[model samples]
Target: MKRRIAILGATGSVGRSTLDLVERSPARFEVVALTARGNVEGLADAAMRTGAKLAVIADEARYDELRDRLEGSGCRAAAGAEGLVEAASGDADWVMAAIVGCAGLVPTMAAIEAGKTVALANKEALVTAGALMMDAAARSGATLLPVDSEHNAIFQCLAGSRREDVSRLVLTASGGPFLGSSLEQMSEATPDQAVAHPRWSMGAKISVDSATLMNKGLELIEAHHLFALPSERIDVVVHPQSVVHSLVEFVDGSMLAQLGSADMRIPIAYTLAWPERMATPSQRLSLTEIGRLDFEAPDLERFPALRLAREALERGEGAAIVLNGANEIAVQAFLEGRIGFCDISRTVERALGEIDASRPRSVEEVVALDGETRDRTSALIAESRP
Candidate 1:
């Protein structure tokens, strides 16, 4: 039987890459639903292309437009948070929880409660509410698979190994567009330059995170949660080529690594076809042409985001939530030309300083904390500006 799949963020880059795999062999999969936050046109296009049965737009105002666009196409349309939750609860064998940021949490939890195998691309969900998500998965028997390249690589390497035999997880980084540049050079960096990642193509926010090494930082927190490893066991290595996704060091003095082209589809397909690998049309890695891979330690003095992320993960009083929430706000500010690239980490650090001592007990509390941090961080940026 063909697997029933619902893509939670069908209009973004990750969603598009997933669509490529599903579209290639429609006989192997069915797209039950597709959703976008506000990209009605893109959502409609994706729905029609996939012949999805349901489409939802998180922006309620765009519902009428989405509904009209999908008219005569045999796909139903919905709007708002309720719509998002309903779509997630619908009949689907698997849900690609690809909604970019913290906004993806509730619906992703809904998918988990619905007992769907969740392909998690939204790192914030785990970073902010990993314990909650893991608990939900354990309760509901939902399989939560990691879709981020680093986490996915670690997953592959540790497939049949005992947790005790595992030594550490080493995540590779592309080092972003400012790899060779000094901190002085980064202070005056522009958004376009930051988003121009050294290896992988990505959106402005994530690309900016790469520039500050904060993307790696966020991934570290995600790894800590997803792999059930502590902050000390997971490490980040700067690999500019982007060929080696991640490595798993064993207690026996050896390491296992997963290497491939920097294509999102590889990991997406890996998760989608878990336990049974599916062939992907991604560009094959050419080690001959891309001769050598270099490794180096991340510069903590230059990229304080990584250090801040470690501190947040350690503090645990909604610090990860604050770190992610603040970074999101600051990244948006920088992208809008409201702040400097360096100020992104500054904003996150300030939010980290103002954190509530109480840790969030539930996903609801996590969401609330994320919202509160975003609001606070936004104000902090504004106050610092003039």
Candidate 2:
């Protein structure tokens, strides 16, 4: 019997990489469902190729197009947020919670509630709704596997170890494209320059996050949840090589690190075959060819987002939700040229300061808080507009 799978963001980079692996070892896995936000063509093509039982588009307006494209494929087609939730909650043993932002929070929670193992790639889901979702997973017995390379590295390093014996987790960063650039240089940086990441190929928003080192900060909050560690226990280092994905230091004066090629597929494959390794076509790591690896402390002055993230995590009172929501708006604004690139962190900081982050007891409240923060951040952007 093959392992049944439903990839929520099946048209994304991670989704495509996962599909690549599944396609090669077709007999090991069964594609149960595939979903995309608005890429009807990509979703339809994937469904047709995989022979999935269902395909969903989160954008309701694109439903007819998706349906038409998937017409003769015999796979069921649906649209809207409800459609996404249905696909996530549908019959499948594993669901890839890779949908972009807080939009993924609900469906991810649905999968967790249904007790389906979830391969989580959306850091915002945990950033915005950590407590609520983690609690839900505990109640439902859902296994939330980490797919982010950094978190996945820590996960692999700590395997079979006593959590109580683990001292701290060290998450490595590539320092993005602006590793040595000054704050002045960064302020004048263009979106194209910002998104030109040195190591990983990613979507625009994440690429910007990486450029600002905000990506590593968000990962810190996520590690707090995933590893049950506090902000003080999680650390970050600027590793330009991206070879050392992450490191874990034990209480017994020892450390373990997971190094691999700077490929998203490595971690995706890790989560796919979790607790058991699987063969992947990902490029193997060659320490000899790579030669030396460099590491340094993140420059908080150049990238204040990382500092802001730590402060938010330390507060632990729904600040992560506000940070994520504000960052999303600011990053998009930056990408659109509505705000200067450096203003992204400034906007998030202002929003965090102005917004009252009360602890959310439920997912509904978390979503509501996220919306409120986005609105406030938008207002700030408008006020800053010339």
Candidate 3:
């Protein structure tokens, strides 16, 4: 039987790539539902291409437009965030949790609580409420599959191996566009320049995080939850080539790595076809043409986001949620030309200082802290600007 799938964030980068894979293998997977924030054109196109049974727009105001577009397409239309969450958890065997930012938490959690197998592309869900999400998964028996290339790579390398035999998991980074720039140079770097990632194409917010190495940091918190590993056991190395997605080291002094060309679909396909591998349309790696692969230690002094993220993961609970929330606001401010590039980390640090620290016992508590951090971060950005 074909797997029924619901893809949240159906118009975003990962979602588009996932649609490509599903379109290719129509017999193996059926697109039961698709959700997007406000990209009606993209949603309409995706629904038509995938023949989704239900299509949802997260913004209620766009309901009429989305419905009008999907009219007579035989796809049901719904509106608002609740609609997205309901569509996500409603009777689909697999849900692709690809919605970006903290906005994804609710829908992704809904799928988990419903005991649906979730292919998680949203790092914020794990970063913000790792304990809450993992506990929910444990209670509901949902299979949480990692869709990020790095985490997915680690998952593949750890196959058939006991968790106790693992020593450490090393996540590889492409180092972004400002890989070797000096602190002085980066402080004045423009958003356009920062978003020009060296190896992979991604959305603006994520690209900026990649430049600051904060994306790697957020991934660290995600890795901890996904693998049941501690922060101390996860490390990041800047590999500019992007050939090796990630590495897993065993207690026996052996390291295993998963290498692939830079493409989100490879991991997306892996997650979609879990416990089974399928051919993807991603580019294959060729060592002969690529020549040499380079690796370097991530400089914490220049990229303080990495240090802050590590500390957040160590602190647990409110820390990661706040860190992610603050980073989102700061990055937006920087992108809007309202703050300096380096000030993003400074704002996050300040927000961290101002927010009260506590162990978030529930998702509600985590969301509350996240909102608090973002508010404080926005105030910091405004005050820091001339």
Instruction: Report, for every candidate in turn, its global Cα lDDT versus the true structure.
Output: 0.90, 0.91, 0.91
- Where model 3 places Cα greater than 4 Å from the true spot, the runs are none
- The residue pairs in collision within model 3 are none
**Which ranges in model 2 have alpha carbons more than 4 Å from their true place?**
none
Worst 10 residues of 1 by lDDT: 197-206
- For model 3, the run of ten residues with the poorest summed lDDT: 377-386
Error of 3 at 172 (Å): 1.0
Estimate, for each residue in 1-386, the C-alpha lDDT of model 2 and write its tens digit: 78899998999888898888888888889998998988999999999999999999998999999888888888999998888888888899988988888889998889999999999999999998888788888999999999999999999998899999999899999999999898889889999999899889988889999999899999999999888888888999999999999999999989999999989989998888877889988899888999999999999988899999999999874898999999999999999989998899999999989999999998999999999999999999999898
**Model 3 vs. true fold: TM:** 0.98
RMSD of each: 0.9, 0.8, 0.9
lDDT of 1 by residue, 1-386 (tens): 99999999988888889999999988899999998999999999999989999999999999999999999999999999988887888978899988888999999999999888999999888888988889899999999999999999999999999999999999998888888998889999999899998788876678889999999999999999888899999989889888889999999889999999999999999998888999998899788999899999988888999999999889883888899999999999999999998999988988889867468898879988898998889889889987
**TM-score against truth, every candidate:** 0.98, 0.99, 0.98
Candidate 3 residue lDDT tens string, 1-386: 99998999999988888898999999899999999999999999999888899999999999999999999999989999779888888968999999989999989999999999999999988899888999999999999999999999999999999999999999998888888899999999999999998888887888899999999999999999999999889999999999999999999999999999899999999988999999987888889999998999998999999999999889876888889999999999999999889999998898888887688888788888888888888888788778
List, in order, the clash count of every candidate structure: 0, 0, 0
